[model samples]
Target chain A: MLEVKNLHVTVDGQPILKGLDLSVGAGEVHAIMGPNGSGKSTLAYVLAGREGYEVTEGSILYQGRDLLDLSPEERARDGIFLAFQYPVEIPGVGTNSFLKTAVNAVRKHRGERELDAMEFMKLMREKRDLLGVNEEMLRRSLNVGFSGGEKKRTEILQMALLDPKLAVLDETDSGLDIDALKIVAEGVNALRSPDRAMVLITHYQRLLNYIVPDKVHVLAAGCIAKSGGKELAHQLEKEGYGDLAGKTGAAA
Target chain B: MASETTTGLPYADRFAAIAATLPGQSVPWLRELREDSFARFAQLGLPTPRVEQWKYTNLHPLTKAGFEPAVVNGQGRGQIKALQPLSSLLPAEEPAHRLVFVNGLFRRDLSEIGALPEGVRLDGLGEALASEAESLAPMLGRAVRSGDNALLALNTALMADGCILRIGRGVSIDAPIHLVFVGAAEETALAFHPRNLIVAERDSRAVIFESHVASNGGVYWSNPVTEVTVEDGAEIQHYKFQDESLDAFHIALTEVEIGERGRYHSFVMTSGGRLSRQEIRAVLDGKGAECRLTGGYLARGKQHVDNTTEIVHAKPHTTSKEVYKGVLDEQGRAVFQGKIIVEKDAQKSDGHQLNRTLLLSDRAEIDTKPELEIYADDVKCSHGATAGELEESALFYLRARGIDETAARRMLIEAFLGDLGEDLASATVKAALQRRVSNWLAAI
Candidate 1:
């Protein structure tokens, strides 16, 4: 569903991602594990078309089309979703109202009928129950004064609502407890289908234990140094990234 | 009377020609008040940029325009009807008693005053002066003085017709009283002065909604003065909406006096007119009084809007709060000047003021000043002002969710102004104001 050829990226004139390449087929889930400064989050941001991230070289193709050419909003309308590491707090903008606007906008772009208030509420309630999110959190302003677990759960709720073709989870397990991690993992597992793909970016092997990936890739110094099965995660956890970096000639 | 060099005012000759035809000319007290106000206006003249109070706002446009007194009668009814939609900001659920005025003259035919309860009187100022002059003798020109502000002095001198509302002691009004002023100047550059008096007696409660709108094709000036007195244990809520013609000018002054244990709440919304200024001065006369003043303004396309307010705490155990916000775009300029004073012996007085502005364009400008003068050691007072562009991260967060750039911007701006709207007590009024804000956003 997605292909990256020698992806090289820079931010503020400093190189972050250098000659990174990866490929994922339909219905496949890939977990990219790396140490600090290994360009995992940079890859997610580049895929979502964030500004100030210069593409020094390389290209990204999604569903046989050049994805980097589209604007961030257009990419969103075309079914690309990025779960932020840190959610933004927009004061005074109700989360319910914002969700309705976003859902309607994407539905309109996809040539589908927009849902009314009642229909949208029904769908939202169903998802909230499935994810164990409270009703009051959905009624308040968008992530304003929210706890770390609540923020991460809200991002997962948005991913469930948008129903994107390709979902990029960026460090979704950084600040979550065991209960929150299970809820988020259950929500993601429910959305898995034959036509959907996901890329999980993480620093630890703990998250992969809940929702196992089809393939695991070790990212070192902006490149995929090793590719293996789910056991590769346990291998890295047992023998840390220090031995791997030396064997793979990784800068880190 | 027309000393051009010494007076420095260009409109003195025009004022002289219109003085003879002003309302209540037969009343000696009214005539003397006008004379005294004229002398004060002549001596003070128009405020210049050099003046400390009027530093950010310039009066050159008003000085250059040759504005004559608007014709009191024979204004086309069709023109007045055309401008009614602009003045209708009240929601349908809340029934209101409306008093319509055209060119500063009362229009009984267009006004819809439902059955008012006993001990309540609402009518035209001219009619009240002619019929019940004795009762109104002590109330007129009592709260507002004629020395410091030149525009207030001008409004007092040429005051023609406005609304007069009086509630008896302990009476409570369920419906809101609306005063809609429409200006239709089609022939010449015209100016009109409107003076409104609202008095809530001891333990009385009421709400007043005031709107100022103008017809499409006109260059006119609407100068209004309003005086409100809240007696002991009384409560009053005042909301003013200003949406004049694109080529017109508006200047208004509102003076309020709150007695012991009284409560006063006011909100102003400004979105139209080429140049506009609304000044409010409030005084807490007795102990344990509370007051809240809040407003929001949206300016664009070279428009200018200014809000100046002052609150005086005269007695102990008084509290006052003020919040004003603005959004400017396309070279639009906005000014906010707020001052709070805690007098001597006014112990335990608490006061707070905040002003915030959002600049949408590169050339837009905002000038804000929040001042506090405390003469008592036992009082708590604070003030703050802020101006900046919208947060880029917030914008991106919304845009990344499939919303376009323009829609994202509108959401952020609405959120910024919605914070102030949430403080309103009436749901109907809040919905109406939200609709108006949406309309303003759509227009831009």
Candidate 2:
């Protein structure tokens, strides 16, 4: 469903992603594992159309359309979702109200009937029950004074509500404990379908235990160093990235 | 103090022409008060930019207009009827006791004061002076002094008519009392001076909503002064909404005195007038008293709004809080000057003040000054002021969620001032203010 060819990205004139290429088909889950300073988060941000990230040379194709030409909101309406590592804390906007606005906006862009207050409440209740999110958390300001676990759950709740076709999880298990990691993985696994795809970006292989991926790709420097099956994660965990970095340099 | 009479001498002649026909001119005490105030105003003239209090505000609008006294009888009820369908300006669901004044003169035909409770009186100042002068002798001009400022002196000198509200001891009025002042000038530019006096006896409770609105596109000046006295253990909430014409000018002064254990809360919302200033001076005279001064102003398209306030803690164990916010767009300019003073013997006094401004355009300007003067070692006082554009991260977060740029900006601005709006006691008034905020946002 998505293809990236020789993606070159720069931030403030400093090159971060250099000639990176990747492709994923429909209904497939890809896990991009790398050490620190790898361009895993940058790829997610670039796909979601964040500002200040200059695309020096590359082309990103999403469902046969150029994704880089769209704005952030347009990309959101086009079914591209990025679950941020650090959810922003908005002081005055209630979480429920924000979710409603976003849901309606996406629905309107897709030429669908907008959900009213009653219908929206019913949908939110079903999602809350499935994700085990508290009702009081939705009543409070968005992510303001929320715990790390709560924030991750809120992001998962939003994902369930929006029901995007392509979801990019950026370090979704960074600050989560074991229990929270299990909950988040369960939430992600429940949304798996034949037409949906996910890109899980992580530094460690701990999350791969709960939500197993079909393909595992090791990202070193900026490009994809190696691609293998799920057994590759166990090998990477047993042996550090020191040997892989050298082999990847020779292969590139 | 440069007392040179170059640009302000014309107002002296204008005041002289209307002195003979003003209300309460026959009373010797009132006559002497007007004469003294006129002399003071002549000496001070209009406060120039050199005056410390008027440094950020320019009075050239008032001086250049050369306004004359508003004709009381020239505009009839038909004109007021034409200005009707005022559902947008009034409260939504609650039944309010309304006192309507046109051009600073009490319009009996347009006012509706539905049967008030016993021991409560709400009427015009002219009527109260003619019948109950003895009871009002000690209250009038007591909270506000003549020599405090130039505008107060001018208001005292040419004061015509305004509303007077009095509540007896131990009585509580449930419904809000609304005082509406509508300004409609004729071919000649008119200026009106309105003086309002409110006295709540010991242990009494009441709420007052004061609105200044203009009906036509005429250029006029509405200079109003209000004096409030909250007796021991009494409570009062005052809301002032100013929405005048774009070509009009407004200058208002409010003086309040809170007794022992009394509570006073005030909120001022401004979104009108070419040039306007609302100055408030409150003093906590008795121990354990509390006062809250909060306001928000939205200025756009060359409009200017200023809010200057001073709160004095003269007794021990008193507390005061102040928060003022402003949003300026286009060439609009705003000023906020807030000062808190803790006297030498006022031990254990606590005060906090904050002023925040949001500049929406490159040319918009805001001048904020928050001052704290503490003479008591046991007092706690803190003040802060900030001015900046909207936060970039917050804006991006909203936009990334599919909200457009304009809707995101409006939501952020509303959230910035949401706390102050939620502080109001009446849901109806809060809803009205929210609607006004939305309207102001839509206009810009």
List of clashing residue pairs for candidate 1: none
Question: What residue pairs clash in candidate 2, if any at all?
Answer: none
**lDDT score, residue A192, model 1?**
86
How much lDDT does each candidate structure score? Answer: 0.86, 0.86
In angstroms, how far off is A203's CA in candidate 2?
1.8
Chain B TM, every candidate: 0.95, 0.95
Residue A118, model 1, lDDT: 99
**Candidate 1: stretches off by over 4 Å:** A242-252, B1-9, B71-84, B91-94, B130-134
Mark the regions of model 2 whose C-alpha exceeds 4 Å error after superposition: A242-252, B1-10, B72-79, B129-135
lDDT of 2 by residue, A43-123 (tens): 988988888788999899999999999988888888888888888898888999999998898899999899999999999
